[model samples]
Target chain A: MQERLYSAPGCTSEERFGEASAAGETLGERMRRSLEQDIARGDLAPGARLDEKEIAERFGVSRTPVREAFRLLAANGLVELRGRQGAIVREIGVNQLLEMFQVMAELEGLCARLAARRITPAQRAMMSDIHARLEAMGEENDPARFYQINLEFHEVIYEASRNDFLAEQTRSLRNRVGAYRLRVTYLPERVRHTLKEHAEVMEAIFAHDAERAHAAMRAHLTLLGDDLIDFIAQFGKE
Target chain B: MQERLYSAPGCTSEERFGEASAAGETLGERMRRSLEQDIARGDLAPGARLDEKEIAERFGVSRTPVREAFRLLAANGLVELRGRQGAIVREIGVNQLLEMFQVMAELEGLCARLAARRITPAQRAMMSDIHARLEAMGEENDPARFYQINLEFHEVIYEASRNDFLAEQTRSLRNRVGAYRLRVTYLPERVRHTLKEHAEVMEAIFAHDAERAHAAMRAHLTLLGDDLIDFIAQFGKE
Candidate 1:
């Protein structure tokens, strides 16, 4: 069943980009999105100074939009705007990274707790469907596909909480830690463990057991943080 | 004891203002601080439109600095920037308010948990002193003094966590909800209940019991949210 779903041509990254363009996003918004993707993908390293002139020239645009993008990025905690040094990709220190994961665990746990109580039947069904897809991706040992599906799975819980402010904050925090977290997805056995953990969270939510769902989500995130710290301890060697 | 401390005129609001002026803060930073105080004190009501020209003239500064102040306010989630209408004090809906409290509870709980494990002796002594002051304020039936002391009590825990990012984020969230929360602090019996709750949290932290501290802080904040909701439902009367 999972294989069939994976075989189908679903919404690819390119399609998402196309949709954004079709929606008539501003130049600054588009530049911000592109720059964010580059940073998250490690194409731009932490502490890399972003020159407005260089970025504008590279993108064949003026510096105004690039500067605007920097402001947007800085607002989201993605970049730091220095007085004369311009904008640099902000680095998360080890302590900060651990602290972020601690907060992320609580936020996600809160989402699961709320979702268990407030999720509509349709939303629960949607989560189950995504969970199934995630399991399939795990079985196929495709970390890349699993990572994307895993994000959608968590996003559904955020929406199910029916709290726009909470959802936005969670999404922003997730993005701030995304670059560091993305590497952890490639670790062996991680996908399998993640699949099991998602199952527990899904089952608890389906049963409307808020406490169980919260605990499951918190434990999952805590373990992920432990794994991430271990991976970093290995000097990020594959 | 708390009466003696309160009578000392320690760091009164006027003195704080004098200190800021003495520090020679930037015009934009000063403007941002002034606007934040207005909003937090309800001097500037929710959804009130802020005009750049008016603010600049009132502060005897240029429109350039006023615009910068607006950006800072927007970044802190205290104001909304509407292109043509300028900046407006953001009105947080009831649901969003509840959600913010939920997240705030978790963040503070995490701080307490970390503080239990990491707090230095000096930090612990400071928290104990603040907690004692809070109890005295409660006995004197001085909610106003209790309110100020209560903030310092939590600040001690945030600092004890030794996580700069987490501390900063927690402080920002607390400020975001401070305006709504201030009214609830005035409710009859609230100060007494809050004093007891602080004692439990302080005792747990002092004992180095991480789980107990976490639970105590969470329960305290959850009750605070419940009281706020009930207080608001009465239309904030009496």
Candidate 2:
């Protein structure tokens, strides 16, 4: 994955070299992480074939670990393993992506609904703090930092829902679409829109308005989905 | 797996012998199906250790297939593979079950909402047809058959959503909590309530009222979850 960092224009050379030297992870784990990150970043395009021998050689490891990593990726819906052809990154078509977003909207809405009713004072405060941090990132036009903080903001709500299973499922679904979602986050208008949406969700939860919280969260996700579709239509052509 | 059938008084001796003679499925596939059914029926019991050697002997198959079946069950979240301790029927505590039901309600509601908006005339007719069959089963007071048909009825709505990904995820989550759901389906009153709830959802869809359809489905699932918890508390004493 560090090797692929050089391909990403956003990363500084110093950062790339620093990451290259970090090698604490096991071979199979590193392979899995690298493959996942590449797929998520569209560095490795959808439907691209991943030859085990090629990946092994690139990572300077044996084919055995690469095969194991493929299994992990397959289990996570990141790749498809063809019998004779080996592995290819799973291609989520527009319709499927829309379907996923629809489900994701509902899941996030459910979390906000529960969080509104069940969130403690401390959790509510944490949400406010995260919201403030997000606003600061937005003002600075730092999408990269804002994107990371945006995840933390959502994580607070997931935790506030107080349902471990629901939180885990929601997070898993989020990860499934994480790659496509990353593209939308780079837009300045989207960052501004997200700040307002987050504020509405936080206010509803603070007021313990479950229905309002649910509606706000649903609206936020629906807008995000629409934005992604629009982005894909206009920018994806290139 | 066949040996466990003898312990279920619901099965006739003739039926048991008939099943014993059937051999179309591969050993591993048969074992997987049998174990899945047993878990869904609660015959295997939560937290019960699945000794591969014992299960292999009982199913008259080698441990290799039994091991393969374990992998299948683990993938489906039916069993947990604790390190060194081997496999155990996954124990979904009360909190986890509630969380699952909450998410299930949202997923079902999302399906109903989409089905209401996007269902074709043919799909609406199919839903009405399934509802009629469900009503007949309810009148006959056949809980077992009602349970089976009930699944078909919900499946119609899932497909009508026109989102394969959402439908598949909803079905997977349903299967995850199926064992507990089976218990609630046995109650005569619960069956009647389900009939009424199905009518509401079908009516809403037929009317093309997305909000109503969503609300009806969510209410139905929420009621089912509450009833399951109540039943577990009162009758699970044994």
Candidate 3:
């Protein structure tokens, strides 16, 4: 295969390099991630056709890999492939989003329960460190940095659960529902309240209080779900 | 693109029709389902190379579709794409299988819990019918029919949960771990025991006992995990 040139004039050298690294990953893996990012970033409009040749050319790969990527994306419910019409990005509906958030709450609750029981001392300390950084970051009111810290906080709970399969499935669900989650980040009260919930979750985990931890996680997830519902109702009126 | 002929002389008419239907399904979807079924049937041996051209020819489709199929399979962790080295079927060992079963149990538990609260009369009737059919199949000692009925029983529980995201995720995980599950069917006692456990789960769900249903589901899933572990220890020494 010839070296495929990817020419997006607006992309910085670093952004191009990142895209290249992403594309250069195993075709299937790269394709899945690329499509996900595109959907998340709103590059691929919902209901837009994802032609194999077009995607392949854009990603500088053969149709083989692109097809595989589409398959993965379709299975994730991100796309719908009709018999002969080709694949289209799926527009997730409100009910499905709510259902996803419900399950996410249960999984996070389980994670917190398990983390309270099994997280190591080192893991506990790491959670503390992340919480401290988040506190510092919150004082500065950097939404982006707070978001990064927020991911780390939840990731600690997931890792501490000691269930690889659960962690992986949860991550995938989070990714699939990421676009709508972006709305929740913009709310000032949501940000402050989320930080407080993170602290409570961390405290419960550190104290090894299983029920408390589970409750905390459940509360946090419920708050997120409620906020998302409100956010969508107010803005995502499609 | 030229449509390839599947003219293998020994293939039967129904087999041909089946093949055509499978092939005629969107190439990507065909590849995804074929790979999934092949893995479930243990047709594609673990660590097996999933040659793009070989699959393309076998499915009577272009490599484009074949590659797309591999991507979905890889996403489900059935295959691993090694960059330029191509893709290989993943060989899940005992520990990983155990981990998967652990997570499966939690998800199923969640399903039962939700089903207990949300199951309608019609859905409850469906569960009863499935359980009755499974019981009758168990009496006949027909493993294949019993297995099919068993899937219906769980799927009923999934629907009763009324959470599409949870139901879909459970279905996908169930498929990914199915190859190992096929081993449990060989144990005669296992079938009878699973049937009895299904009764307990159904009874709990019928009574609208959320906690009891959740507990029953967890107990049933634990047995599955134990049985799979034992089966792997004795027969799956890979």
TM-score top scorer: 1
- Clashes per model (N, Cα, C within 3 A): 0, 0, 2
Tens digits of per-residue lDDT, candidate 2, B1-238, equal 2123224436532233237534444455567767887777666778788998887766666786687667667766789876556888988877788889989999999999999998999988888888888877666866667777899989999999999999999998898899888777668778788889999999999899999999999999999989878987886642
Q: Give the i-RMS of model 3 in Å.
A: 2.3
**Stretches of model 1 off by over 4 angstroms after superposition:** A1-31, A57-65, A139-142, A236-238, B1-30, B139-144, B236-238
Better of 1 and 2 by TM-score: 1
* Least accurate 10 contiguous residues by lDDT in model 2 chain B: B1-10
For model 2 the local lDDT of residue B90 reads 89
Better of 1 and 3 by DockQ: 3
| Model 3 agreement with the true structure over B1-238: per-residue lDDT tens digits | 2221222234432243247565446656656776677676566667777777866776667887677667668778888877777888888978788888877888899899999999999998888888887776656765556666788889999999999889988898888887767667558888778878889998999899999999899999999998887787787585
Give the Cα lDDT of each candidate: 0.80, 0.80, 0.77
What is the two-chain DockQ of model 1?
A: 0.38
Q: Is candidate 1 or candidate 2 better by DockQ?
A: 2
TM-score of 3: 0.85
Clashing pairs in 2: none
